[model samples]
Target: MATNGVHIIVSGRVQGVGFRWMTKMVAAKLHITGTVANQMDGSVEIYAVGASDQLAQFEAAVKASPTPSGRVSDYQATPLDPVPTFKNFDVIG
Candidate 1:
């Protein structure tokens, strides 16, 4: 299976709610490699690289709001032409 990358932006009640941490946990479970961070705009940004099916599952998990306190109103995922390489998923920023 070919690997793929996605840049995801999650909006609404995501900051200060363990969203990034939860994202990291989810990524690990799905064997995804990348980073999740809290954006200045009260949104969460995630860059994930994994198998295509795993990427789809990751997207759904993200949209489902990994944290109980987090509410994902909008989830925008864009495919990356050149997939990023990361040793492991991390909670950044």
Candidate 2:
């Protein structure tokens, strides 16, 4: 299958709660390559590359809050044009 990419923004009680760590783990399991980072505005930003189905699954998984204490109030995913190259899923600062 061809690969696709998405840019996601997760809001609400996400930062400082292991959200990025859990996102990386989930992305790895789905064989997705991307980056998860905390935005200065209290949201979590994600850039993921994978199959379309996997990206949908990833969005669901992240919105459900895999981290013990994280709460995701909003999840928005936008299709990326010219998917960025990523070697692996990473938690970035």
User: What C-alpha RMSD separates each model from the true structure?
Assistant: 0.7, 0.9
> What digit string (tens of lDDT, one per residue) describes model 1 on residues 21-83?
888888999999999988888888899999989989999989999999989999898998888
CA error at residue 72 for candidate 2, angstroms: 0.8
Candidate 1, residue 68: how far the Cα is off, in Å: 1.2
lDDT of 2 at 83: 80
Clashes of 2: 0
List candidate 2 segments past 4 Å from native.
none
Residue 2's lDDT in candidate 1: 96
How far residue 52's Cα lies from its native spot in candidate 1, in Å, is: 1.0
The 10 consecutive residues of candidate 2 with the worst lDDT sum are: 51-60
Across 1-93, the per-residue lDDT of candidate 2 in tens digits comes to: 989999999999899888999999999889999899998999999999999898888888998997989999998989899988899998888
